[model samples]
Target: MNFAEKYLSIRKHTEQLCGPLQTEDYVVQPVADVSPPKWHLGHTTWFFETFILKPFSSNYQIYNEDYNFVFNSYYETVGNRVIRTDRGNLSRPSVSDIYQYRSYVDEAMVKFLSNEIKDDVNELLVLGFNHEQQHQELLLTDIKYILGNNPLFPVYSEFKSEILNLPSAAQKLLNIQAGVYEIGFNGDGFCFDNELNRHKVYLNDFAISSSLVSNHDFIEFIADGGYSNFNFWHAEGWDWVKSNHIKAPMYWHKIDGKWFNYTLQGLKPVNDEHSVTHISYYEAYAYASWKGMRLPTEFEWEIAAKHFNWGERWEWTESAYLPYPGFSKAPGAIGEYNGKFMVNQKVLRGASIATPEAHSRITYRNFFHPHLRWQYTGIRLAK
Candidate 1:
C-alpha cells in the first residue's frame, strides 16, 4: 500500500480496537504507566497537529488551543505539558470531545497527504503511523489492565484467542553457532532511530529455547517458591518482589488451589499450553535463573530469532536499552522519541500479539522498567 493508504488504514485500526469499550472505559487510567484510552486517542491526533499540520499545512488552525498542553507528552521542545501521572485525572476532555479532535486532525492530515509530499515529510508521516501503531498495542494492554484490575472484572470483548497446539516435545533449546553477525535495520522501510546503524558483533556459541516458556513451565517455578527465594533474583528485583508481596504474574490469582487469570474474554482458567505472559523483567530473570539459564542479549536474540518462532509475546532480553554504535538523535521534538529512553531500562525483543500488523521488525527494541509487567511480556531461556 502507498504511504497515505497505509496511514489511513492504521488510523482506522486504532479506532476499531476501541469498538468494545464503553464511554466510561475510555477515560480511566488504571496505572501511571498506562495512559487513558481517550488520552491515547487525543495524543495521537495531537502528534499530527503538532508535527505535521502546524508546520506543514497552509493556514492550519489549531483544533483546540488547550489540547497542545494536555496531550503533548514529554515533548519539552514543544512546550510545557501535563505530567505523566496527571493523565488519568483529566476529565474535561470527554471521550466524545477526543473523538471530535481525532476527526478534525484526520481530515487535515488526509488533505496534506493528497499533494505530492517531499521525502522528509513522507518520513515524518510514516513515523507518525508507526507511533500510532505503538500506541495501538498500548491501548489494548491498558484496556486489559483497566478491566483486569477492576473489582467487577468486566469483559472487554467476546474475542477468544486462537489456541496454538505445539507438541510439548517440540520445546527444545537450539544450539546457536554464533559468530560475527550483523544486526540492525538496513532496508529502506521505516524503522525507529534506535534500530539503525547496522553493525556486527561476535557472539560465543549459545543455545536458546525453540519456543517461549509456557505457563506450565512458569507454574513449576511458582510451585517451587520462586517468589520467596531471593537467590534467583537481582537485588532490585528481589526488593520489588518483597515490597509489593508479588506472588505471581500480574492478573493471576489462586482460588481454592485452582489457578485463574484475566484474559481479554474476562477471567478464565490459566492455559497451560499458552506462553506465559504479563511477567515483569525481574520475574523473567528469576525464572531463567531458577533453570540455571539466562535471558539472551539483544544481539544474541536477534541472531537466533530466525530459528525460532516469536511474535506471541515480547520476550525479555538481558541487554540494556542503549543506543547502537554511531547512533545520533535528530534535532527537535521528534528526536526525543526513542533516544531519551535509552537508560536504566531493559530491552525486549520480538513482538506480542497485541502489536499491530507490520509493526514489528527483527531489529525492533521494546524497552520498559524491569518492575513493570503490564504489557504482554514473556521469558526465553538461553545458556
Candidate 2:
C-alpha cells in the first residue's frame, strides 16, 4: 500500500477500536500513566496537525488554537500541554469534540498527502502513523484497565481476549553460545531513533526459555510464598510489593480459593494454559529468582528472540533502558520521543496480543516503570 492508503487504514483502525466503548469510557483515566481515550483521540489528531499540516501544508487551516494546550503531550519543544494527571479532568473537550477534531485533521491529512511530499515530510508522516499505532495499543490496554477496575467489572468487548489457544509446547531452554553479537534495527524500514546505532555486544553463554511462563507456573510461585519471601525480591521490588500489597498480577482476584482475572470479556477463571500476563518487571524478576533463574537482558532477548514464539505478551527483560552507542535525538519536538524516558525504566522485548499488526519488530525497545503491570506484560526465564 502507498503511504496515503496505509495512513488511512491506520487512522480508521484507531476509531474502530473505540467503537465498543460507551461515551463515558472516553474520558476516564484511572491512572496517570494511561491517558483518557478522548485524549488519545485528540492527541493523535494534534500530532498530524502540529507536525505535518502546520509546517508543510501552506493552505492548511488550524483546527483549534486552544487544542495545542489540550492535546500536546510531553513535547516541551512545542509548548505547554495539559498536565498528565489532569487529563481525565478534561471533560469539556467531550468525546464528540475529539471525534470531530479527528475528522477535521484527517481530512486535511488526506489532502496534504495528495501533494508532492518531500523526503523530510514523508519521514514525519511515517512517525505520525507509528505514534498513533503506539496509542492504539494503549487504547486497548487502557480501556481494559478502565473497565476492569469498575465496580460493575464491566466488559469492554466479548470478542477481545488476550487468552490465545495454541498447541502446548514442551518448555525448554534455547542455548546461545558465548560470543560477540550485533543488535539494534538493521533494516532500512522506519524504526524509532532508540533502535539505532546497531552495534556489537559480547555475551556469556546463556539459555533462555522457549515458552513464556504460564498461569499455572505463577500460581505455583504464589503457593510457595513467592510474594511473602523477601529473599526472592530486590530491595526496591520488595518495598513495592509491601507498599502496594501486591500478590498476583493486576486484575487478578482470589475468591473462594480460586484464581480469576478480568479480561476484555469480563471476569473469567484463570486459564492455566495461557501465558500469565499483566505482570510487573518486579514480579517477573522475583519469580525468576525464586526459580533460580533470571530475566534475559534486552540484547540477549533480541539475539534469542527468533527461536521462540512471542507476540503473546510484552516480555520483561533484565535490561535498563539506556541509549545505544552513538545514539542522538532528532532535532526539535520529534527528538523528545524516546530519549527523555531512558531513566528508571526497564526494557520489555516482544509484543503483546494488544499490539497492532506490522508494529512489532524484533528490535523494538518498549520501556516502562518497573511497578507498572497495566499492559499485557509477562515473564520469560533465563539462566
Candidate 3:
C-alpha cells in the first residue's frame, strides 16, 4: 500500500476497534488510567490537526478551536488542556461530535497526503500514524478496563483473544554470552526519536526464559501466599498491595474455589495454558523474585529476543525508562513527546496481541508506572 492507503487503513481500523461500543460505552472511564473510548477518537484526531495539518497544510482550517484544550495530552509547549484524570467527566463533546471531528481531520489529511509532500511533512505524517497506532492499543485496553470494572460485566465483543500455544518441549533458558551488543533502532525505516543514537553496551552472560510465565505458574505463586508474604515484593510494591487490598491479578475472582477472570468476551475460566497477563510490574518483579530469578533488563531483552518468540504480551523488564547514552530530543512540542517521561517509569519490551501490526520493533520502548496493569502486561524471567 502507498502512504495514503496505509494512512487510510490505520484510520479505518481505529474506527473498527470501536465498532462494538454502544453510545454510552464510549463515555465511561472505569479508572483514571483508562480514558473514555470517545476521548481516544478525538485525541488521535487532535494530534493530526495540531501537529500536521495546522503547520504543514496551507490554509488548513482547524477542526474545533476548543478541541486543543480538550484533547492535548501532556504537551506543555502546546496550549493548556484538561487534566488527565478528569477526561471521563467530559460529556459536552458527545460521541457523535467526536466521530465528526475524526471525519473532519480525515478529510483534510487525505487531501494533504494526495498531493506531493516534502520529506519533513511525510515524516511527521508517519509519526502521526504511529502515534494513532499506539492509541489504538490503548483504545482496546481502556475499553476492556471500562467494561471489566462495570458491575454488569458486559462483553466488549464475542471475539476471544487467541491463546498462545508453546510446545511442551523442555523450556530451557537461552543463554546469551557476555559481550558488547549494539542496541536501539538503527534502520532507515521510520522510528521514534527515542530509539536513535544506537550505541554498544557490555552485558554479562544471562539466560532468558523460552516462553512467558503461564497462568498456572502465577496461580502457584498465589497459592503459596505470594501476596501474604511481603518478602517477595518491593517496598513500594508491598505498600501498593496492602493499600489496595490486592489479592490476585486484576479482574481475577475466586468463587467456590474456582478461578475466573474477565476477558473481552466476558467472564470466563482462567486458562492455565495461556500466558498470564494484566499483571503490573510489581507483580512481575515479585513473581520473578519468588522463583529466585529476575526480570531481564531492556538491553538483555533486545539482545536476546532474536532467539525466542515474543509479541504475546508486553514483557516487563527491570530497566527504568530513561534516555539512552547519546539520546537527544528535537526542538518544540515534538521534543516533549518522550524525553520528559524518562523518570520513574519501568520499561517493557515486546508487544501485546492488541498492539497494531508493524507498530512494535525490537527497539520499541513501552513504559508505565509500576502499578498500572490495565495493559496486556506479562512476565519473562531471567538470571
The lDDT leader among the candidates is 2
Model 1 Cα lDDT, one tens digit per residue, 1-383: 87668778988999998999998888888779988999999999999899989998898999999999999999999999999899989997998899898888888888888888888888888889999999999999999998898988899887746233434448889998858999999898889999989999999999999989989999999999999999999999999999999999999989889889998888889989789999999999999999999999999999999888788899999999999999999999999999999999999999988998889889999999899899999999999
Pairs that collide in candidate 2 are: none
What's the true lDDT of residue 24 in model 1?
85
- Per-residue alpha-carbon lDDT of candidate 3 for residues 1-383, written as tens digits (9 for 90 to 100): 87779888999999999998889999997677889989999999999999988998899988789999999988999989999999999997999999899998899988988999898888888999899999999999989888899888898888757354544545689999999999999879988887877989999999999889999999999999999999999999999999999989989999799999999989889999888999999999999999999999999999999888888899999999999888888889999989999999999999998899899899999999999998999999999
Give all candidates' CA lDDT scores.
0.91, 0.93, 0.91
Worst 10 residues of 2 by lDDT: 160-169
lDDT score of residue 89 within candidate 2:
96
Give the clashing pairs for model 3.
none
**What TM-score goes with each of the models?**
0.97, 0.99, 0.98
| Prediction 1 TM-score vs. true | 0.97
Position 12, candidate 1: lDDT: 95
lDDT of 2 by residue, 136-196 (tens): 9998999999999897998888888685555667899999999999999997899999999
TM-score of 3: 0.98
TM-score of 2: 0.99
> Cα lDDT for residue 137, model 3?
96
**Of candidates 3 and 2, the better by TM-score:** 2
